[model samples]
Target: MTEMSVQLEQIAVRAARGVGDALRAAFVQAQQPSHKRDHHDLVTEHDERTEQVLRAELLDAWPDSAVLGEEGGASGDGAVHWLVDPIDGTANFALGLPFFAVSIGAVANDQLVAGVVYDVMRDTAFSANLHGAYADGEPLRSTGPATDAQNMLITSYPGPGTLAAGRGVEEYTTLLREFGAVRRMGSTALALAYVAAGAGCAYAYGIHPWDVAAGALIVQQAGGRYLPLPDTGRPWEAPGYLAVNGDFDLPGSCLTDLLPRMLPRTATGTPLPGGGLRNRP
Candidate 1:
């Protein structure tokens, strides 16, 4: 790996780890979340506070960097752009569920070079660079069952955006019947991290850069497939994604027919009315 890639990965980890303690303390402490888009899309004070801290830390560590955060829009302008989701699963965190995480990714030269996804309550760090993906510093290999009939599928589909596009339910129904199992995990970042750790084939819809940038690098580094929906040649910027486990046969799976068809046209129409990624019209 280049020295820059390794350095960026360390910087991301430090910035994410720096905020773990504060997140743990406020995990289930009567957080009153307000609607961002709706009740389905929520944000807490902790989310803003954490993002501020992270953005500061990241920029301070690498002065030649910018940040595009979930809570805060693009700030600073440099070669290294940092994508951050201080609280990836805000709904889960506000509801006293232990599934939220901190996600940070470094994009330089329009390519993802380094990233980290920290599971706050669990204290596990999933990270990646040009070299490979790692969970708490151990190498990862995203192997799983080859076919959908025998493998698990994880997603947050049928979301407000998916439903708005009028395509998710029928496709979801097909997934429900074809996959061996299905899980609707609130955190897209963690779902991708899980896929990198050999958990299951997963998909996410209408995600911002902050949501999947880190997880994308981690999944791809772990010997998995990161398919950017709409396939605009820029996985980091694309709003939709699918992360399949290493051994999974994506072409043989049901997803090949459903999501790829729905995304290109649907993503442009997916609503992001309140407090979504800026300049996404």
Candidate 2:
């Protein structure tokens, strides 16, 4: 990795850890979560606070950088673009479930250079840069069971949104029946982190850039496969993704059959125009 990429990785990790303590303290506290789009979508005071903290830390560390945060929207107008998901699994965090994370990914000139996914409950950080991927400072290797029948799969597919869109329910059902086991963890970042750590394969439909940007880089750097389904021109901007340990068999799995049906028709389905990267000023 170049020195600049390493520096970006360190910054991302530091920025994420800046608010870890507060999130830990608030994890179990009673929270009144307001709906974002519907009952299935939720946001809390902690989410907003955490995003604010992350935004301040990132911009302070690298003044010439922009942040695209899930809760706070876009800020700054610099060369490096940071995608932030302060509290990925708000419902899980609010309900006392220990399965959420702080995800931050840095894009320099349209290329993902660094990423960090901090698992607040476990106090473990998964990070990646141009150099490589690591979990708690240990190099990660995405090795796992080779077959769908032998591997575990984590996904939150066919949620209310997917069902409402009238897509992928039957395919998801087939996956549940075929895979060794399937789990819905709610946190997209953690799911990809786990895959990087050689835990299991993960697939998701209808995800945002903030949700998978960091995790996607981590997966690739760890020697795993992270594909934005339907091959949107920019991988991070895709509406859905399929990620797996390096050994998982994509062609043999049920996912191969489901891919065509899962992806949206257009190449730029979600329309993140001019959002890939920026020129350094």
Candidate 2, residue 187: lDDT: 98
The all-Cα superposition gives candidate 2 an RMSD in Å to the true structure of 6.2
Give Cα-based local distance difference scores for all models. 0.86, 0.85
Weakest ten-residue segment in model 2 by summed lDDT = 272-281
Question: On residues 1-281, what C-alpha lDDT tens digit does candidate 2 reach at each position?
Answer: 36778899999999888888999989868889999888889999999989999999999898989999999899999998999999999999988899999999998878888999999989999999899999987899999988888988898766765577787678888888899999999999999999998876988877899999999999999999888764665678877787899988666777665655555445334432223311111
lDDT per residue for candidate 1 within 1-47, as digits (tens), equals 36799999999998899999999999857999999877789999999
Candidate 1 — worst ten consecutive residues by lDDT sum? 272-281
How many collisions per candidate? 0, 0
Query: After best superposition, candidate 1 residue 237: deviation in angstroms?
Result: 0.6
Query: How does candidate 1 fare on TM-score?
Result: 0.90
lDDT of 2 at 211: 95
Instruction: Give me the candidate number with maximum lDDT.
Output: 1
